[model samples]
Target chain A: MQLAIVVNEGPYTHQASDTAYHFTKAALEKGHGITRVFFYHDGVNNGTRLTVPPQDDRNLQKLWSELGEKHGLDMVVCIAAAQRRGILDADEARRHGKDASNIAAGFRISGLGQLIEAGIEADRLVVFGD
Target chain B: MAQKKKFLYLNRKAPHGTIYALESLEVVLIGAAFEQDVSLAFLDDGVFQLMAGQDTTAAGMKNFSRTFKALGDYDVRKFYVERESLAERGLTVEDLMPITYEDENEDYAEKPSIHLVGRAELAAIIADQDVVLSF
Candidate 1:
């Protein structure tokens, strides 16, 4: 089964981000396929390649990258939301004239159409929110 | 073959907190207005929306939960509850507003239908949807 899991919470607070990650991992372990991991609202922060957590803590951004690489999961950040929150890719950063953009590897900016596609293409679409 | 769009709305916020529900409602209404089929499913805290008797008037909010009943008027007849969430909250269909659903069918349909499933089965819902938006 292919799943499109959405995370709507920021990485710092709320369990939605963690829940999305755990659910994705479990889905893979259970032999289900993940079509994409769409991040919206503050959840776009998960794609920020520049976030710095304490050395003692797990770098969630890296974990997400590993998940994407290992399972080939599509980590799509909402383009409008990501821009509003300053989570930009290299191109977006250049477009917006921002000094830095931290979009993590394996994550890309996409449109609402992607969300719609997720629902149609995926067998299950799970949303994690605050 | 030409077919109507099968749209699923993923509402993640509580009513009255923000415009998420209201905005989502507009999108669904627009889709239905354009002749597409629409369905709604609640997950996690979103399940709270299905609970009965929401009184947000005192909070200076538009009784948005009241708008749920109107979804039927807009041809959005399928309202679903995540069975696991209900169980975790010690709630059930009986605890929610009278929402119509085909509890028997496990597969997706053109008409509105409710799916009562566990976590494992929930993954299938994600896999089956053509479009999924979280609000």
Candidate 2:
């Protein structure tokens, strides 16, 4: 089945992003197609490349980026939410007159329409959040 | 046009002190453009979202409760408020704002959009949906 995943909380502070990652990995292993992985609310924090966890701890941002790269998944961070939380792509940073962009690889910023489209296109929409 | 999917926006948080309720409403407005069969479910603290006379002046946040009124204009009408959730919060349907929509199929009659339903009934409604987006 084609499934869309929504992660609504940030990493470390919440288990939502971690669980979503494992779920997506398992679903992909089973050969089910991923329609999209939408990050909203604090979940947009997962797309920032600035996070640097201790070498011993698991790096969730890297994990997600790698997963998206391996699966060619449509990983999208909601632009509105991202901007509100200061997670910016290079273009967004330039537009906002910020000095730097922090959006990690394999994740793109987009509108909420992508999420609605995912709901319409995917057979199931799974949400992970508080 | 493709088949219209049933979309449910599930609300489980309070109106203030968090961004979920406001953001969820934003999605509902945006999603309305897709012409899907959309429904909003208010349970737990989410019932506070529809409470009448919400004054955000002291809180200093945007009084977004008024936005719910505009949803009717977007062709997004159904709002399912769980009966048990209200009772637990010591609120009745009368405590909520009077949100209504004009029914084009019925000579443009003004009709209430909120539907007070029991937990079981809400569950059945949820089962009938193609997509359920929770906040």
Candidate 3:
């Protein structure tokens, strides 16, 4: 089954993100196709290029990026949430005269339409949340 | 396309505290991906999901309430705000931003429709939905 996974937690502080990631990986291992991963609320922070973790810690952002690269997956962050939290892409940051954009490769900042489309298109849209 | 199922995501708790807010987002998005019509209502403590001008850095948490504004991207515009919940907590719809706030009433899409009702009424609303997951 094709599944759409929604992630509402960031890598730190909550296990929500970890749980979603593992679920997606396992689904893939089982030969299920994941339509897309929608990140909202603090989950949007996962798209930031500015994230820096300690050497000993796991780099979840890098892992997500790699997942998208190795396979064709769409990682979408809600724009409204990103903007309210002051997260902008390189284009937006440059256009808004900000210093930089954290929404970079492996993830694209989009409206909820992708989510809607995925939900409609995917066979099963299983949610993993708090 | 499948007929859009009405999905109302009720969010409680602030961003980065626990995974409540994040988990809600995921479920809602997944619902939408399934071509279900999804709406989000912030009530009681859930209203905090739309609070603006947060200082999460002090708490070592990245503020994601602004993500509420992004609901438009998900085609999530219907918001059911409880009047009593706002007043009891000293919060007014004006205090929140980027939300199409509504009072609990017959017109309010939430269950019971009253701005505030007893727990029994709330339960009926939950029972009516194809899905009602809490944060």
**C-alpha TM-scores of all predictions:** 0.60, 0.99, 0.61
Stretches of model 1 off by over 4 angstroms after superposition: B1-6, B10-36, B39-134
Q: Write the per-residue lDDT of candidate 2 for residues B40-94, one digit (tens) a residue.
A: 9999999999999999999899999999998999998999999999999999999
Taking the tens digit of each residue's C-alpha lDDT, what string does model 3 give over A1-130? 8888878667787888888888898899899998899887677888887889999998888888888887788889878667767779987788789987888579988876676666666776666555
Q: List clash counts for every candidate, in order.
A: 22, 0, 16
Q: Each candidate: what lDDT?
A: 0.75, 0.97, 0.69
Candidate ranking (DockQ, best to worst): 2, 1, 3
Interface RMSD for model 1 amounts to 4.3
Ranking by lDDT: 2, 1, 3
lDDT of 1 by residue, B73-111 (tens): 666777656788888888887778765433235563344
| TM-score of chain A, predicted model 1, versus the true chain A, to 2 decimals | 0.95
The TM-score obtained for chain B by all candidates, in the order given, is: 0.78, 0.98, 0.71
Candidate 2 on A27-94: residue-level lDDT in tens?
99999999999999999999999999999999999999999999999999999999999999999999
- After TM-score superposition, what is the CA distance of residue B24 in candidate 1 from its true location, in Å? 4.1
Please list the residue runs of candidate 2 whose C-alpha ends up more than 4 Å from where it truly belongs after superposition. none
